[model samples]
Target: DAAHTAMWERLDLDIEAHDALLAVLGKFYGDIYLAQEGRLKGAEYLDFVLSEVHGLRIKELQDAKAAGKKIVGTFCVFVPEELTLAAGAVQVGLCAGAKAGTELAETLVPRNTCDLIKSFIGFKLARICPYTESCDLIVGETTCDGKKKAYEAFGEHVPMHVMEVPQCKAPCDRTLFRAELVRYKEALEQLTGQTITAEALAEATKVVNAKRRALQRLAALRAAEPAPISGRDALLVNQISFYDDPVRFTAKINELCDEIEARITKGQGVAPAKTPRLLLAGCPMAVPNWKLPYLIESSGAVIVGEESCIGARNTRDCTDETPGNLDAMLDALCDRYMKIDCACFTPNTERLDNIAAMARDLKADGVIHYGLLFCQPYAHEAMKVGKAMDAAGIPYLSIETDYGMEDAGQLKTRVEAFVETL
Candidate 1:
C-alpha cells in the first residue's frame, strides 16, 4: 500500500484520522446499508468506493498530475464536469458531509448557517479534506445568499471560481448563464493550458450523459413496490457518484440496476410489502448526512424518491449529446442546469410540480419535506411546498434539522407519527 500511503502524503492528509473516519463509516455502512434485506448485486463496489474514497481518487489524481493534468473540485451540481473533462482536467466533489470540522467552520461563519456550507469550510479550514487539498481550483456557485458570502471567505483561502447562478429561469437568465459558462470555459482553458474543442466537449457530454442515464435507471428501479433498494443505499450511490471515476461509476450503477431489475422480477425488496412509501423533498443530503432518511426508513416507511438536489434533481436530466458544436453544448448544459428547481429561484413552481409528479408517479403515501436548520431558501419554501402538497392532496411533513443527533429522538417521534397516519 505504498501508493496509498504516498497519495495521502502528497496531499498532506492525516492518514490516521482518515482511517479512523473510515472505521466509523464502515460500522454505519454495515448497520444502515448492509443491514437491509435482500440487497442487490454490484452494491459491493459502492462499498469499496466509500472505503477508499480519498485513497483511490487521490491516487488517480496523482497519476493525472504526473501526466500534467489538473484537478478541479466542485461543491455544487451547477458546476458541470463536462467542461472540466473537455479541458483535459478532472473534477471531484469536495467533502461536505462530515461533522468533524463544524466548530472550526463556525469560527469563520455564523454558527447558524446550514451544516452543508459549514462542513465545506470546516474541511478546508481544518485541512482534513484530501479532495479539497488536491484541487487546482475549487468551483463555487451562487445557489443562495449564504454560499454567495461563503465563497468570498472561501476565496481568500483557496484558489476558487464562483459561477453566477441565476435565481430565475427567464430568457434573460439563460443568456446571463450562458455568458458565465463561456467565462468558465475560458477559465478552464487558462488553468489547463489547452483549448477545449467542440469534439472534446461533445465526447465529454456523452460521458456525463451516460452517467446520468445510469443513475436515472437506478432511480426508476427504486419506484418499484417494496423498493428494490433502500433509500439509504440509493442515497449513498448518488453521493459516491459525485466523487468516483465517471466511467467506472456509470458501469457499476448499470450493473446495480440490472441486479435491482432482477429483484423486482422476483418481487424481492429491502422494505416489507405494504410499507408506507415516502418521497423526500428539499435540501441536498450530502454523504454522511443520513440522519433523516435513516430515521424515516427505521420508522417503518420506505423512501421511494427524493426531490432534493442530491437525488432525482441531480440525475433526472442529461445534456443534449446531439450538440455538434461547443456553443450548442454550452447551451445544452445551461438548459439542463436551469431546469433544476432550486428553492433559491423566485416563483419556483417547477420544484412543486416535480414534487407532485414524483409523489404521484412513485405512488408515495406521503412527502417528507426536509430542510436543514437555518437554510433560508428551503426553510422559506417549505411553507409554499406544504400548501402545494395540501392542495394536491399529498400528505406532507416538514422537518427542519441540523447535522447533530440532538434532534433524533424528536424527529423519530414525529416521523413515526407521520408514518402511522399514512
Candidate 2:
C-alpha cells in the first residue's frame, strides 16, 4: 500500500482505477486457482495456454492498450508498481506464459546464472511476450546483482531504467532508505517524463491502501473453506496482482470461487493422498523445488502444506496496513515475507523454530530444504536447520540445486537416502 501510494503521489494515477485493477488482478488469481483445482491439466484462458504463456499479465497489457494506455513490462523484483503508476504507465512483471527458459538457457545468458534468471531472460530472448517489442522502456531493480548486470547488458537492447540499491545490512537506516527512495523517484520521473507532488503522495497512499486491503482479503479467502487455495494455485495468484485490470479482475475471482465450489461438490478438488503430509518451507520455490513436491508424493509422502513464499507465505501474522509511511510499509512487507519464507533465510534459532512448528502442524515425517548451490543464506544455516530437525527427531535434508542439469542425479541419490533414513 505504501508502494502504491508512493506511486500515486509520483504518478497522479486514477486511484479508483488502480484499486479496481488490483482486485481484478487478484481475482484472476482466484480464477486460475479454481481452474487448476478442476484438473484442467494446463494453465489456459479461453482454451488456449500460450503455446507460450502469458496469463493476467497479458490481460493487463492488452487491457491497458485497449484503453490507449502506455504500459511498460520488465523483470521481477525491480520494476516496482509504484513507479509505473506514478509515471502514468502500468508496469507488468515479466512472468511468461509458456515459461520456456531451458532453450533460452542455451544462449541468452551464460550457464552459471540461476534457472529462474535463465528461464526469464530466455523467455525475453525468445520474444514470447508481445509487449517486449512494444515496450517503450524496460526497467530493473537492485534486489539481485545478477538482474542488475543482466539489465545493464540487456539495456542496450531496449529503453532501460535501473533502481539504485545501496547495500544496507542489519537494520537498514530510514534516512538512507529515503535517499534511495528519492533516487528511485528521480529515476522514475526521468523515465516517465512526469513529476510527483506532495499532494499526489497523500492521495497515492489512499489508492495503495485499497490494493493492500485487497491483498489482505485474498489471504483471508485462502484461510477460508476446505482451504480454497493450494500451493500450485497460490504461485499463479500472487503474480496476477502484478498485472491485470483490478475491477474486472475482482469479478473474475468471484466467478472462480463459484467454479471451485462446483469442483468440490464433484469431489475433484483436493488431491487424494495416502502418504504422510509434509510442509516444504523456504525461498521462492517455483524453480527446482517444483519437482520436489511431486517427488515426495511419489515416494509415499503427501505434501499437505507448505511455508514457501512461492507457496503459502501469506497464511500467518498479517498486518492491518495503511501507507503514508513508505519505509515502515516496506519493512512490514519485508518482515512478513521474511517470516513465511523457506529455510533460505540466514539460518538462526528462529528459522529452526519455524521448521519444528511446521513439522508438528503438518504431521510431517521430515522437512526438505531446497536451495541453489551458491545461495548465501541457505549455505550458512543448512547445518543448523539440520540440527533443529534432528533435535526434534524430525528428518530433513538440504538439497543444493543448479536447475534441470543432471546435477539432479546426485540429488536423486541424496533424496533417496533421506527417504530411506525416514
Candidate 3:
C-alpha cells in the first residue's frame, strides 16, 4: 500500500482525493457487487481485479513504461486495441463512469456536456484517475459533438490525439476511416518508436479477438432459462475487460464462462427462471457506473444482455485477421470498427435491428433504454428505439439519469413498475 501511495504520488495524483475515491468505490462495490446472491465462483476474479484496479494494475502500467512501452488510454471503443498492442503499447480504457470533480469539469467543458465527457475532464482536473494520469497518449474520437469539443479542452491537460470517426457507413466514409486508421497507426508508431509489423499486428488481432469471443461466450450463456449470471455481474465483467490485461482478462473471463455453462447445465442461476428478463440498450456504462444496472436487477428483473458500447456494442465484432500485409490489415481494422452501432452515426438502423435481435435472441421480456442526462445522440435515439420496440411487440422503458444517486429511489420505483408489466 505504501508503494502504491508512492506511485500515485509520482503520477501527480491528488493523493487525498484519490484515496477518498477508492474508499467510496470499495463501499459501493461491496453493497452492489459483494451483496449479490448465488454468484458464480469465478466472480472472485472480478473481485481481485477491482480490488487491485488502482494499485497493482497501475503498477503494471508503470512497469511497462519502465520497460520502454507506451501506455495508450482511450475513452471510446473506436480506438483499435490491436494496433496499440502491435505498436508495443498498453491500451487502457480511461475512467469516466463516476461523478467526480464536477465543478472542476464544468470549468473545463460546458455544464451541459454529457456526464461521460465531464467525468473524464473531471477525473483529469481532479487528478483522481491513475489511468488518465498514466496515459502516454490519450486517443479521442469525434464520435459526438460534445466529445469533439470537450477534447479541445481535455487536450490542454493531457497528450491528446483526436481521430476523426466518420459519421456514416458509406464507401467514402470507409475511405476516410481507413485513412484515420493509418493516422492512428502512425501516432502509435511515433509514440512507441516501434513500427507496427504485419506479424505483430496479426498476433495482436488474435489476442483481441480471443477476448471478444470469450465475452461473446459469456453473453450467449445469459440466454439460458434461469439466467446463469446476474446482469450486474455480467456488466461488471464487461467493464473490467476494458481495464485489465487483455490475455489475462480473456482467460479469466473464459473461466467464468465455463462456470456459467456448468451453472446453466445444472439449471442453477442467480434469478428464478420466470423472472422478467430485460435487455439494457444505449450508452456505455464505464467503470463504477453500476447504478442503473443495480436498480434494474434489484427491482425483480434479470438483465439478459446489454446493447451498449460497454456491453455488446464493444464486444460484438472482431477485426479480420486474414490480411497478410500492413496495408490490408489496416483495411480489415477499418471495416470491423465501422460495424459498431453507436448513435453517433446517421441512419443507424443497424442499432435498432441489433436491439430487437438481442431482445429476441436473449428471450428478453422488455427493453430498458438508458440515456445519460445531456447525452443528445442516445436521448434522440430513445424515441426511435421506443417506436421500434413497440412495433416488435416488446415493452420498453427509457431512463435519463446521471451518475448521482439522488434519483435512485425514483428509478427503482419505475423499474419495479416496468417489471410488473412483464
Off by over 4 Å in 1: 1-3
In the range 1-422, model 2's lDDT, one tens digit per residue, is 56434434333334554455346434543443344433433234312322112333454455566765566766543234544565566665555322353565446556565655665566456543344544666766554555556676667656776755434324553344445556766766776677755444444434444454444444444322234435454344444544445444444444555555555565553444333445566545542124555455445444545554443443344432454465555444344333433332222466577668766755666787766555555555667777878788887777667545466456666666666766
TM-score of each candidate structure, all chains considered together: 0.97, 0.65, 0.99
Give all candidate RMSDs, comma-separated: 1.4, 9.6, 0.7
C-alpha lDDT (0 to 100) for residue 42 of candidate 3: 97
Over the stretch 1-422, how does candidate 3's per-residue lDDT look in tens digits?
89999999999999999999999999999999999999889999999999999999999999998999899999999999999999989999997999999999999889988899999999999999999888999999999999999999989989999999999999999999999999999999899889999999999999999999999999999899998899999999999999899999999999998888888888898998799999999989999999999999999899999999889999999888799899999989998999999999998998999999999999999999999999999999999999999999999999999999999999999999999999
Best by lDDT: 3
Model 2 TM-score on a 0 to 1 scale: 0.65
Q: Which window of 10 residues has the lowest lDDT sum in candidate 3? A: 257-266
User: Against the unseen true structure, what C-alpha lDDT does each candidate score?
Assistant: 0.87, 0.51, 0.94
Compose the digit string of candidate 1's lDDT tens values, residues 182-202: 999999999999999999999
The alpha-carbon lDDT assigned to residue 154 of candidate 1 equals 89
Models ranked on TM-score: 3, 1, 2
Candidate 1, residue 52: Cα displacement in angstroms equals 0.9
Report the candidate with higher TM-score, 2 versus 3. 3
